[model samples]
Target: MPSLPTIVLVDDAAEVRSLVRLQLRLAGLGEVVGEGADGRDAVVLAAQWSPDVMLLDVSMPDLDGLGALPQVLEASPRTRVVMYSGFTDPALAEEAVRRGAVSFVQKSTDLDALVGEVRRLLPGEQPAAAPDAVPGAEDHDPRAAARELEQHVERFAGVFDDAAIGMATLTLQGRLVRANSALARVLGRESADVVGNHYPEVVRSGGDADGRLTAALERATRGDDDVVEVEHRYRGSHLRTTFSPVRDQRGRPLYVFAQCQDVTRQRQAEDQLRQAERRFRLLVEAVEDYAIFMLDPTGHIASWNSGAQRSKGWTAEEIVGQHFRVFYPVEVARSGHPEHELMLALRDGSYHEEGWRVRRDGSRFWAHVTITAVHDEEGHHIGFAKVTRDNSERHRLLEEQERYARALAEANERLERANHQLAAAAEDQAQFLAVTAHELRTPVSVLSMSGRTLGEHWRELDESERDEILEGMETSSARLQRLLGDLLTTSRIQASTLDLRLEDVELAAALAPTVDELRRVHVGAELRLEVEAGTRVRADPGRLAQVIENLVANAVKHGAPPITIRALAVEHSVEIEVRDAGEGVPVELLPRLFERFTSRGAGGTGLGLHIVRELSRAQGGDAWYDPVRTAFVVRLPASGPP
Candidate 1:
C-alpha cells in the first residue's frame, strides 16, 4: 500500500465518498489513503500524507472547497486538487481553475468519467477493469448481445445530460444529431445551437483532418469492434473524441456514439514530461565516471546507461534485462546482500558502501556504490538508481598506508598524529568512508606532514616556526573533533535515537560558550552576539548551543567576517539569525542546503547544517538558510516573559 499512488477523498456526503472509493478500487486507479467530511479535514489530510490527487467537494460546512483551495495546496504543494460539484456552471468551473485546481469535475459525471479525470492527473498507466459480462456467440439468443449493449447505453444515457464529458450521437454521414449541455458549453453555444450541424463543421478542423474524420465515421458504421480516436478543436479546448459504432445481431450499421473529453491540459502535461524524459536520458547516457542504472522494484534491471556499459563491460543490449544481482560476487549473491542493499535503500532512502563488484568478464573490482530509492511525484517507491564507481586503486593505497602506519607505530612518538587519525577509523569506518573520505583525508595529510616536518628538522626550526606548526596542528585536531561530533549527532538523528531535554533557556547565556570557543580558535575573525534582554526559548540547551555553533562555523568557513549572531523575540517564537557579509549560498544549492551531504563546495563535513536543522526540529523548532539575507536562521518556540 505504501508503494501505491495515494489519494485523499473529501466530500460532505458519506455515500459519495463510498461510491468513489469503490470505483477507484474497481479501476485500480489509486489508493484512498485518507477521507474527510469537510474543507478543514482536507487541509489536515493533505498535510499529513501529501497525497498525489485530492477530490475536493465544492460545498461543505465551516469552510468550503473554494476557501480551502489555497490552504490545501500550501499544506501539500504537490497535490493536484480537483473541484467536485453537482453544478455544471461554466463560471464556477472557470473560478475553480483560476483558484489553483487542476480541473473542475461535475459530481453528476458517470463514475467511469470521474475515474478518468482522476487518472489523468496522475502519471503512469492505469489498469483497466475487465468487462464483467459479455454475451458469447455460443450462448447468444438473437436479442442477447443487443440487449446487453443497450443496457450499458441506457445506463450511460441516464447521465448523458449531466455528465462533464461531451457526448453526441452522429448519423452515418458524420452529422451531429444531438449534443449535451457540457458539449454545448465547450463550444460556447446552447445544445439547440450545436445540434444538427455537421460534426466536421462544428469541430472546425482543416480539410485534411475533416476528410480523415469523415472516412473514419464511414468506417465506424461498418463494425462495432473498431474505435476511431480523433482530436477536434473548438474554441480553445482540445477535445479527444472517440467514435464507437453500435451494431445489431446481423451486424447492420447503427448510430455512431462519440465521447469527447477536453484534453488540452493533459496534452501539454504529456509534452512537458516527454521533453524532460528526453533531457534526462541524454544526461544519463553522457555520464561516464560511474556505472549508473535503474532497477525495478523487484530488483530486475530496468535501464542501463552508457556509464554502466563502459564500467561494467556490458552493452545496454546485453545487460538491460538481467537481474541487478548479476553484478554481485557469487558468495555475496548467495548471502542475499544484493537484496539487503535494495531493502536498505527502500527503508532509508539510500544505501552506500565500498565493496567488491563483479564485471561481465568475471573480474572483481572494489567499488564505491550508492543505491538511492526513486519515488514518483505521487510518493510511490518505484525503483532504485544505483551508481557504482571503481575505487580499487584508492582502496589499495589506503591498505598500504594502514600497513605503513602499523609498522612504524612503535618507532616514534612523533608519528602519533597519524596513529590517532588512523584510530579514528577504528569505529564506523564504513560510515566515515562514505561521508567524509575527502574531508578527513585532507586533515590527516596536514597533521602527518606537520609531524614529519618537526621530527625530521627539530634543530633547524626556530621558536616562531614551531609555534605556527603547533597552531596548525591544533586547528586540524579541532576540525577532526567537530567532524566526529557532527557524524555522531547525524547518526543519532537519522536513526531517530536523539534525546532532547527541553526547557526555558536564556538565548545569550547558551551561546556564550560557543562564542568563546570560536573567538579563541579564530583569533583573526570578528564574531558578534546580540540579543535583547529577557530573550529565551523552549529548546534543549545542549542542542541549542550545538545548532548555534554549527551555523557560526559555517559562516566562518563559507563566508567573510565579521559574523553576527542575533536572537530576537517575535510573537510566540524566537529567531536566532547568524549572518556574514559574504555572498549568499548559490541559488541552485539553496533549496537543498539543509539536506544531508549537501555541500557549498567548501571544506568541512556536509552534516553540519543538516544536523543543525534536525536538532532544532527535534526540540519543536526549525532551521533554514535565508539566501536573501545571507543568513542561516533558527526559529524556536519562545519561553519566559517578553
Candidate 2:
C-alpha cells in the first residue's frame, strides 16, 4: 500500500473537528497528525506537523480561515490546504481558490465524496475501480444508496447539534421532531423534553400565546415562497423567530424549519432610542428664544421651530423652503455672507460668528450665528443645522461696559488731583448718603403703617380688607429685604467678595416657589407662569430666586397687570423672562435699563436691574431686555445631566 497521507484538522467547534477526524480514520483514507480550534493555532500546527494536507474551517474566532490561508501556506509550502465550512457561498469559494486553497468543500457533502477528494489531493494516492464493478454502479446499488443516506443523516446531526444559533425541525402537525442544543437552551429545557412537545403549545405555556408563530408556520407550510418572521415575547424574554418550509420533490411541505434568537436587549435599546428622539423633538419645539432650524445642502430652510418664529419673526409656513439668507440684512445678504458661512461649515464642519440679521418687520438686530454640518455614516455631507440668537442687547452692554471702564479710569485720575479738595468731595458724599437714607425710609414707613393696621383691627376688618393689609405688609417686607440684599451685594462687588455655590438645580422647582411668593406679594396683579419641567441650571438657587423676584417685582411696579413669567431650556443654557401686558419702556431708557440707580418709576432705588445683571455675570451668564415684549430676560448656564 502507498504511504498514508498525514492531515491536520482546524475548526472552531471541537465536535466538528472530532467527527471529521473519525470519518477520515474510519475510511482508512488518511492519518490525522494534529488538530486546532482556531486559525491562529492552525498556522502553528501546520508548520510544526508539516502535514500533507490541511482541512481548515472558513469561519473561526480571532482570525478567519481566509485571513490565515496565505500565512499558513507561507509557513508550510508543501501542505495542500482544503477550505471547508457548513455555509457554502460561491464568492467565498472563489476567494479561497485565489488564496492558494487547493479545493473548497461544504461540511454537508457526503462522507464518501469528501474522502475521495482528500485522497486525490494527497501525494501518490490514486482511486481505482474494481474489474467486477461497472461504471455508475453505486448509482444503481440499493446498499450504496442506503449508506449514502446514513452518512448524510450523520453529517446533518453533527451540524445541528453544534450550531451557534437556535434551530429546530417541526412535523406538519406542529410537533417538534428534532431540536438542537441551542434551541433547548433558548427555551430553558432539555433537548429530549423539546423533541416531542408541540412548539405552539410550549410557547403558550411560556406566556406568549400570540398565535403569531402558528400563523407563520401555517403560511410557510402552505407551499408559500415567503419566509415568515416575527418578534415574540415570552416569560420576560424577547425572541425573534423565522420560519421556512422544507418541501419534497413535488413542492409539498414535509417539515417546518425554524430559527429563534433572543432579542430582548436589542428591543430595549430600540425603545430607549425612540424615547430619546421624542425628548429631543419636544426640546426643539419648546424653545422660543433662539432660532433653531435646519437647512438643506443648498442653504434653504428645511425645518423651523417656535423659537425661529419668535426670533426671526417668520412663521414656519412662510419661512420654510426659503433661503436662509432671507434673515440676513439687505447689505449682508447682498454680500453673500450667508453662502460664505455655509461654505465654511462644509469645509471645517462648523462655523460661528456675530453679525447683523433682519427680522420680518425690516428691523436689523445683532445676532450670534452658528452653522454645523450634518453627515451620514459614510461621511457624506447631508445638510446643516443653524442656530441664531439676538445678541443686540449683549453687544450694547459690551459697548457700555467699555465706556464705563474708560470713565472709571478718568475718575481715578481726577480723584488723584482732587485729593487737595477733600473738603468739597466730603460734602458731595454726605449728600449722597442722605439720598440713600431717604430711599430706605419709604419702605420702612409703609411697613410700620401696615403692621399697626393689622394689629389694631384684626377682628374688625372684613376678610378682603384683612387680606389686603397682610399682602401690603408682605410686599413692604420683601421690598426692604431686596434693598438690604442690593446694599450687601454692592458692597461685596466693591470688595470683590461676591461668590457663588453653583450646582445642578431644576428650573421648575426653583421658579415655582418664587412665582407663588410673587402672587402673594402682588395680590392685585395677575401673575401667570409657563415653565418647562426638568429644565436645569448651574447657579446658586438663592441668588437665582432673587433675580427672578426682582424682575417680577419690576414688572408689577412699572408695567401693567397680567404679568407672565416664562422659562425655557435652550442649547447650553436656560432662559427666564418676565413679560407684562403694557406698553414697553421708552427706547431712550432701554440702553440704560441695567445702570445703577436707573429707575423709570417711583419707589425703586435703581439697583434691582443692576444687581440682577451683576449676579448673572458672576455665574457665567448674563441679563438682557427684550424691548419689543417689555420683558427682562436672564440666561444662565444649564446643568444638564452628564
**Candidate 2 Cα deviation (angstroms), residue 412:** 11
CA lDDT, candidate 1, residue 236? 62
lDDT, candidate 1, 173-259, per-residue tens: 454545677777766667665454567776664233545555666667654333576675556666666676533212333345676
TM-score of candidate 2 to 2 decimals = 0.32
Best candidate (score: TM-score) = 1
- Give the per-residue lDDT of model 2 (tens digit) for 74-176: 9999999998754443545666787799988866423345566787887666673322333454445534434454464456457666777687766455656
What is the RMSD, in Å, between candidate 1 and the native fold over all Cα?
34.2
Off by over 4 Å in 1: 1-434
lDDT of each: 0.72, 0.73
Give candidates' CA RMSD values in order: 34.2, 38.6
Error of 1 at 549 (Å): 1.0
For model 1, what is the alpha-carbon lDDT of residue 471?
A: 72
